[model samples]
Target: MHTSVSLKALALLVFCCLSTFAGAAGKCERLVATGNPEYPPYLWRDPQSPKHLIGANADLLTLIGEELGVKIEILYTGPWSRAQDEVRTGRVDLLAGAFLTLPRLEYMDYVHPAFFVTPSVVWVNKDKVFPYSGWEDLRERTGGTLVNNSFGQQFDSYAKANLNLEEVPSLTQAFQKLLLGRTDYVLYERYPGVALANTLGMLDSLETLEPPISSEGLYLTLGHNSACNDAWLRGQLAKKMTELTAAGLPETLLQRNLERWKVQQSQVVAPPPTQDDSQ
Candidate 1:
């Protein structure tokens, strides 16, 4: 009887130890993802709540955290260039949404099957005219784009070589220049342009050229040096993405959040302008 009890106690101890190790392994406290705080309708700071970030990508990340049983802490890093640097140097565990580029592959591994597609399009003022069939058609026209934004590395290169392209700080400024007749065309992402135009009440003034220049898939990229770099983590993330896609979680969530943003924008009461005595 004592022998059986001893064996039972030994088995219980072994199971307890294994359980403790498994729990420790699964204890994921915080997940860090880098993003530009200025990019609107995708990843941006909430105007009313500056400390809180909001956008489609931010909502998607929150959903992902819930589905994966992990806590996500967003680090509002500036600009795509700096965000990439953070991901590359292991300062951030992942980049929330990033286009797959050759240079990026050196520092991170992309999750299989991108989560979203962004179509690049050219926006032109309704008053100024141009017959644009493609990038080639814009050779004679002046183009504008964000300073560090890449429609595509190849397309950017072509624009540099073939057109008189001006780099600006933000797409909002690019559109301003376009409206003021400073540039003939501005290239930007179609969805974002739509949201931004609506926000600035410039939808009627600017139009997106049909037939997008190119569409790129955006993925959640894991840092090469992260603890979650193993195949198991990759598989887990892939499974989570598949489940989310199957449930149409990405689209539904994005639509709902976008509608909220639209309502918020509409409710914003612009302050009445004061009369200028100098004028």
Candidate 2:
């Protein structure tokens, strides 16, 4: 009777464990995600479907969902700031792409082995190009970038301490300022900046200097407050990300999306929205 009772207890414990695992997995059946809506190639508001975001990051999240048997929806929650807020409050479960930072770490858990490394460069109007070889070259010059944007923690700290950068609400505004000669240069990621310049019809006017300011890894983050923030979901995401990165899938997706953005841009003759338009 003693042995039988012990066996029964073991069975009950196993059953409880399975039940807990299933419960946790069930809560993650559908995840809502958001990110910087204007970040082309990586992420952007689908011109055809403005309510949804479509880009390489969105494609990656969709593949992750397929592998994990969870449905992930990347939405255009609002601007970059509002998207971060949505993730912070658990209104959204995922950040499609984000840079690692101390403040952001407070509200999100970064997946290990960042999926992509992005290079941020100094963009200047072609007619006003300067001899920028390093960070020190911009010590006294004024630069501009989208508000809440970060190149990397090291660069962010350095810029705060030693650089003069004006913050603007949108990339459109930042580039506009650069073109108008209001700012010496605008710091932004390479491919996305290229894509945006192409869309804004400003590609001929802009050029990026060599020796990029910072090369930072972009990560997919799970909100700290998300109901789906369980060990199972986190482990699965990290595992799939590691597999996909190893397979070199992100690069293929980025190139494909670059062409996709160009095709979409060609279809629309009217200019894209601006900072004032968003406000």
Candidate 3:
């Protein structure tokens, strides 16, 4: 009789716990976002697994999803261009991270209080020196940069008018051109440049110049035509993101993930220890 009563109590407890969890999770079932899989120390595709993306931005998004009672999946859909296309078409609900662009505004609504900001820096080969103080300094040099990568509204306008840059397929390609002396410099984010350079074993060969070409906020936005776009969801996310920013969550995550990447990358480079043969 005692065993029967205990079993009934346990079942009732499980039912109540499940009901509470469902009530919380009902706010948002899931949110999908994708962008620039090459970007690191912010976002990037895990080398060990192509389908999963890992980095600072991914960590922060996970926290945001938890706060919203939703599952935020950062998928490696394709190249940066394809991800942007998906977001624009509303086939994907969100752009994982992006800068504010006039064109993007037409198809997506940016959430309030951007999660982070990053600078577009110029990286040059160590032996090839260019004293860069501003964008005008780049006007004379033939640089390489990824296609569809934007620095900012003002910088983009100026670069289009005055800068001579060869648009490559990806950051790695652009950096390769710079390394091979095909391009004078490469335009990319500072952290990603450092991360990629380290990954490529080119850390000793490259240097990032100051000042940055332009610094822009990295944001999450909902596609305008998304069937799941809800005003309440947008407002809730905005509030939560702002609170997260105030708590310095994104910055903290970036540092932690940066260290994690270092460890992971080192493990990749090192060979496994051989079994002892002394016995």
Best by lDDT: 2
lDDT (CA) per prediction: 0.75, 0.90, 0.82
Q: Residue-wise lDDT of candidate 1 within 167-222, one digit each (tens)?
A: 76566678999999999989888877887787778999988887788898878788
Better of 1 and 2 by lDDT: 2
Return the lDDT, model 3, position 256.
89
The sequence of per-residue lDDT tens digits that candidate 3 reaches over residues 1-279 is: 999999999999999999877654444588888888778888887766667678888888778888877788888776677778888887788887889988788899999798988988889999998777888899878988876778878888888899898986567678788889999999888888888788888989999899998899999888987766777778877888899999999999889888887888888854222212121
> Which stretch of 10 consecutive residues in model 1 shows the poorest summed lDDT?
270-279
- Give the clash count for each candidate: 0, 0, 0
Number of the predicted model whose TM-score against the real structure is largest: 2
Query: TM-score per candidate, in order?
Result: 0.79, 0.90, 0.83
Selected candidate, larger TM-score, 1 vs 3: 3
Best-first order by TM-score: 2, 3, 1
1 or 3, which is superior by lDDT? Answer: 3
RMSD of 2: 3.0
